[model samples]
Target chain A: MSDLKKLGVEVLSMSVDSIYTHKIWQEEELSKMVEGGFPFPMLSDAGGKVGQVYGVYDEDAGVENRGRFIIDPDGVIQAIEILTPSVGRNDAELFRQVQAFQLVRASKGKEATPAAWQPGEPTLKPGPDLVGKVWQVWKPK
Target chain B: MGEEELDLGCARPTGGPVGVQPDQVPPEREGKSIEEVRKPMVSVGKKAPDFEAPAFYEGKFKKIKLSDYLGKWVVLYFYIRDFTFV
Candidate 1:
C-alpha cells in the first residue's frame, strides 16, 4: 500500500457485501491481518451493479469474482486481470506493472519496458533499427 | 517464399470495432450469450466506466465516485467477499 501511495496511486477495493458486513470483517479479521486495517476504501457494491460493468459479477453465486483494473490519470484503463476464488493475486507483479505503466506514460510511449523489467533496467526504444537487434541488447537467461 | 521469408510487415493487430457506445445499451443484448455479456466493458485503451457506490472509509460510510480520483492512478480491485484470505 505504501509503495502504491509513493507512486501516487489510489486503491479502492470492492465486493457485493454491505457496509455493515465490511465493518465487522475489518474490525475482526482484516485489522489483525494488516496493521491499522486496510489503508484504502472498501466499497460495498450492493447488487453487483459495479461488478457487472467490470464483468466480475457471478449471478448464479450472487457474488463477484476477483478482478482488478489499473486506471491511469486520464481515467483510461491500462490493464485488467480477473481471477477465480481459488487463486490469489500476486502483489509484487501488480506493483511491477504499475511501475511499468508509469514509465510508459511518462515517456509518452517512446519507451517500452521488457519482460520482468525493473526500475533501473534498460527499456526498449521501438524503431526499425531495433527490430531484430533486440536479442543483442536484451539477453534472456 | 518460406513462412519465415514472407514479410507480413509491421502492422498492429486489429480487434473487432466497438459497435455499442459505452453508456448505451446494445440493441441485441438479449441475443448475446452469457460470456459476451460478462466480457469486461472497459478495455486497455478505452475510458473506464464511471460509477458511484457506498464505501466504508476510515470508520465512516460514505459515497465514493470513480471520477473523484480522476487526477491520480487508481488500483481498483474486487474480492469475492470480506473476511476471506486475499
Candidate 2:
C-alpha cells in the first residue's frame, strides 16, 4: 500500500474488530510493518454489515474472510480476489492489476491488456482482425 | 473486467454483478472455520454494494460509508482479524 500510495491510490483496511482493537493493533503490530506504519484507515465492521456486503463475513466463525476488492473511480468493482484465512494476499499482483485496469480504462475500449502486462509493456487491440493473429503482435514475457 | 480491477473501495469477485442480498449465506454456519465460508456474492464487472461501517481514522472512530468516496479509486480489503497468525 505504501508503494500504491505513490501511484495515487488510496487503501482502506477492514476488520471485524472494534476501534479499540484496531487502535492497539495499529500501535503494536501494524505500525511495525516493513513499510513502517500501515498508511491507511482501518474500518471496524462491527456488525459485519459491510462484511456481508463484501461476502467476506463468515457467519459461523463470526469473522471475515481474506478478501481484496479493487473499485474503480466510478464506483464499480473492477477486480475481486478472495482467499482463505491462512492465505496471504499478493500485494504486488494487486498493484499490477490496478495499473493494468487503469491503462485499459484510459484507452477507452480501444486497447486490451494481456496477462502479466506491465506499464509501458505492449497491450493488445481487440478487434475481429486481430483475433487469430494474437501471437503475431504480443510476445510472451 | 471487474470493478475489483479498478482501485476503488468495493467488494471482491463472486458472480455477475454484486447486487445480491448481503446475508445470502445462512446464519447456521457460524461455528465453521473461515475456510468454509460461502463464496462471495460480488464479482468483477459488477456494481459494488454500498455500506456503512465504523472506521478508525485520524485518531477517532468515524462512520465511513462506501458512498462517501466518489470520483476516486479505492482499494478495499478485509482481513480476518487483528494481529493474528498469518
Candidate 3:
C-alpha cells in the first residue's frame, strides 16, 4: 500500500468480514499496523455486495476470494485477476501492472505492456515487432 | 506505363491516402482521442457499479455506496486473508 502511495496510486481495500469482526480486528490488528504504520483504509463488505459485483464471493468458502481489479481513471476495467483460495495475490506483480497502466495511459493508448512486462521495458508493436522483440525478452531456462 | 502504374508511385503503404499523418492531428480535434477512447478500470467514465451496504466509517453505521464517489476515482481491492504472512 505504501509502495502504491509512493507511485501516487490511490487504493481501497475491501473485505467480506462482518462489521463486528472487522471492528475487533481493526482494534486488535489494524491499530498495531497503524502504530507500525500501515496506512490505507480498510473497507468492510459484510453483506458481500461488492464481492458479488466483482464475482469474488465464494459461497462454499463463505468468504471473498482473492481478487484484484485495476480500474483505470476512466472507470473502465483495465485488468482483473481472481486467484483461487489456495493462491495469494502478488504485490510486486500488482505494482508492475499499476506501472504498466500508467505507462499505457501516458502513451495515450499507442502501446500496451506485453506479458510479464515491466515499466521502461521494451514493448511489442503488435505486428513485425511482436516475434523478434518478444523472443529477445523471453527468459529461457 | 499505364495511369494506374503512375498512381501506384504516389500510393502509400497499407494502400491508404498518402501525406496524411494521423498523429499530426490535435487530440481534441480528432473525433476520438486516445484518452477519450481508452476507459480506465475504475473511474471517470462509466458509472461505477453501485454497492450500498452497512459500514463502520469514522464511527457509527454509515451507508457506503459507489454513488458516494460519483466523480472521484475509487479503487476497491479485496484480499482473501488478513494478518497472515504470505
Candidate 4:
C-alpha cells in the first residue's frame, strides 16, 4: 500500500457488510494478516447500492461480488476487473498496473508499456513506423 | 437459472440469436435493453460514479466519498464480504 501511495494512488475497499462487521473483521482477521490492519479505508456499502452502480452486486444474494476499478485522477475509470469469489486478486499485479497507468498518463499517451513492464523498462512509442517492428525493439525474456 | 449456471458473458438461455425470439422473451425483461437488465457496469474511460458511504478506518467510523480523492489515482475495489479470505 505504501508503494501505491508513493505513486499517488488511494485505495478504497468496499463491501455490503456493515461497519460493525468491518471493525470485527479488521480487528480479528485482517490485523493478523497485515500488520496494524489495512492502512486504507474499509467502506460499508450496505444493501449493495454502491455495488449496483459498479455491476458487482447480486441482488438475489444480497451481496457484492469481487470487483475492482482503477480510476485516474480525472475520475475516469482506467480499468475494471470483476472476478468470482473463488479467485483472489494479486497485489503485485495491481501495483504494477498503477505504476503503468501513472507512466502512461505522464507521457500523455505518447508511450505505452509492454507486457509486465516495470519501472525503468523500455516503453513503446505507438506509430505507423513502429508497427510490425515491435519484435525488433521488445523481446520477451 | 441456478447461480452455478451463471456464466459471465453467456447469452440468456431464452435462446436463439441475440435478437431474441419473441416466444422466448422473459416476461419481466421484455423490451428492456441488455444494459438495463444487467447491473449497470461502469466501463473504462467513463467517469467513475461518485458515492458517499460510511467507512471504517483506524478504529473509527467515518463517512468517505469517492470524489474526495479527486486529483489522485484511486483503487476502488469491492469484495464479497468481510471476514472472508483475501
Candidate 5:
C-alpha cells in the first residue's frame, strides 16, 4: 500500500470485524507496519453492514471473500475479481491491470487491449486494419 | 463404462464426438449468452450505499459517513477479518 501511495494511488482497506478485535489486531499487526512506514487508511466495518452491502459477506464462514474491484475516477467499476476463501489475490497482476486500464483510458477509445495483454504492447483498433495491422506489429517471442 | 444402458442426452454412441442434442440444452442456458453466465455481486452504475459508523482516526473514535465523501472517488473494500493476512 505504501508503494502504491508513492505511485500516486490512493487505497482504503475496510474490514468486517468487531471494534475490540480490530483494535487488538491493529496494535499487533498494523502498528508494526505503521512504525515501518505504511501510508494508507484502514476502515473498520464492525457489524458487517458494509460487507453485506458489498455482497462479499459470507455468513457461513463469517468473513468477507477476497475481492478486488478497480473503480475508475468517475466511480465506475472497470474491473472486478473475486476469489474464493482458499485463494489469495496477486498484487503484481493488480499492478498490471491498473497499468492496462490507464493505457486504455489514455488512448480514448482509439485502441483496445487483447487478451492477457500488458502496457506498452501493441493495441488493436476495430477497423479494416484490425487483425492484419495488429499481427504486423505484434512480435510474440 | 457400462453397456447396460447409457442415457447422456446424446444420440451418438459412447465413442462418438461429444455434442449436445437439441433437447439436451439446459433450461438455464436456453437464451443466455456467455457473458450472462454469472451476474455481478453489486451493480456497477448504481449509487453507492451510505453508512454512518464508528471509525478510528488518529487514535480516536470518529463518526464517518459515505455521504461525507460524495463528491470524491471512494474505494470501499471489505475484508473478512481485520488482522488476517490477505
Candidate 6:
C-alpha cells in the first residue's frame, strides 16, 4: 500500500472472490470510496484453493478472515498475524515491522531489534556482554 | 458503538456491496466445512505453500503465483470482503 511504498515494500491481497468481481470493486467501490484503488494485485481464490492452503478461507462464513503473512526475501515467513472479520489490521505496526525485518535481514542475523524498535535506532547485538546488562545499557525512549 | 468505533486505531472501511458479490460461491464447496478446511494450518519457519489464482492488476485479470515474488519481501494479506463493515 502507499504506506509501505516508502519502505520499498509491496503488498498482495488474497480473498475468496473472483477476478472479475475484484476488478469491479477496485474500480467502482474502492476507488470512489477510498483514496486510491489498491496499488497491488488482489488475488482471487474463487474456488478457495489458496485460501484452504492458508486457512484464511472461511468455509462456513463464506468469506476469508483477516490474515497476514510477512515473508522474507528468501521466502521465509518472518511474521504472521490473523484476526477476525470484525477487527481490522494495524497498518502502522505492520509498516514498522517491515522495516525491522529488513534491517535484521540486512545485518545477516547478526543484529536483532527489540520490540517497538524504530528505524535508525540502535539494534541489539546478541552476545554475553549484552545478556544481563541489556537494561543497563539500553536506553528505552 | 458509533463514537467508540470512530476511536478505533484502524481505518474505517468504506463503501458497501455494489449489488454484485465475489461471484456466486457454490453452496457445496467440495462438501467441506471450516473444520475440515482448516485441518492443516500453515506454520511459521516453513516454506509457504505456493499456489496460483486469478489476480486483479493494472485493470486486468491475470494469473499470479507466489513464486513470482520469490526474491522480494511479500506481505500477503487477506480480508473478509471489500464492501462489508468487516
- Superior by DockQ: candidate 2 or candidate 5: 2
lDDT of 5 by residue, B1-86 (tens): 01122232333211211122345556877786432322233566565545554444444444455545533444455566665665
Per-residue lDDT, model 1, residue A20, is: 68
The stretch of ten residues in a row with the least summed lDDT in candidate 5 chain A is A36-45
Q: lDDT tens digits, residues A51-122, model 2?
A: 776788888999989988999888799998889898888888998998988888888879998978888888
Candidate 6 global lDDT = 0.71
TM-scores for every predicted model = 0.83, 0.79, 0.63, 0.80, 0.66, 0.79
Model 1 C-alpha lDDT per residue in residues B1-86, reported as the tens digit of each score: 00111122353211111233444546677666654654667778899887766677787766677877888999999899987775
As a whole number from 0 to 100, the lDDT of residue A1 in candidate 6 is 75
The residue ranges of model 1 lying beyond 4 angstroms of the native Cα positions read B1-39
Ranking by lDDT: 1, 4, 2, 6, 3, 5
Best model per TM-score: 1
Candidate 6 is graded, for docking, as acceptable
Question: A36-57 in candidate 6: lDDT tens per residue?
Answer: 7778887776656566667777
* lDDT (tens digit, per residue) of candidate 4 on A1-141: 777878778889898887678889989888888888888888878867678778898888888888989999998999999998889989799988888899999999999999879888999999998999999889997
Q: Candidate 3 on A67-137: residue-level lDDT in tens?
A: 77776666566677777777777789888988888787777877777777877777655556565666675
Better of 1 and 5 by lDDT: 1
lDDT per residue (tens digit) for residues A18-111 in model 5: 4445556666778787773323445556545455556676768777777666665555666666676666777778777767776776788687
Tell me the TM-score of model 6: 0.79
Q: What does the lDDT read for residue B8 in candidate 1?
A: 24
* Model 6 segments more than 4 A misplaced: A34-36, A139-141, B1-38
Off by over 4 Å in 3: A33-38, A125-141, B1-48, B53-64, B67-74, B81-86
Per-residue lDDT tens digits for candidate 3, residues B1-86, read 00111112342211111122447656655786543322222323344455444444433333454444433334567777566544
Clashes of each: 0, 25, 13, 0, 1, 0
iRMSD, per candidate, in listed order: 6.1, 4.7, 11.4, 7.1, 11.5, 5.6
Cα lDDT, model 4, residue A141: 77
lDDT of 4 at A73: 92
Q: Which stretches of candidate 4 lie over 4 Å from their true place?
A: B1-38
lDDT of 1 at B73: 94
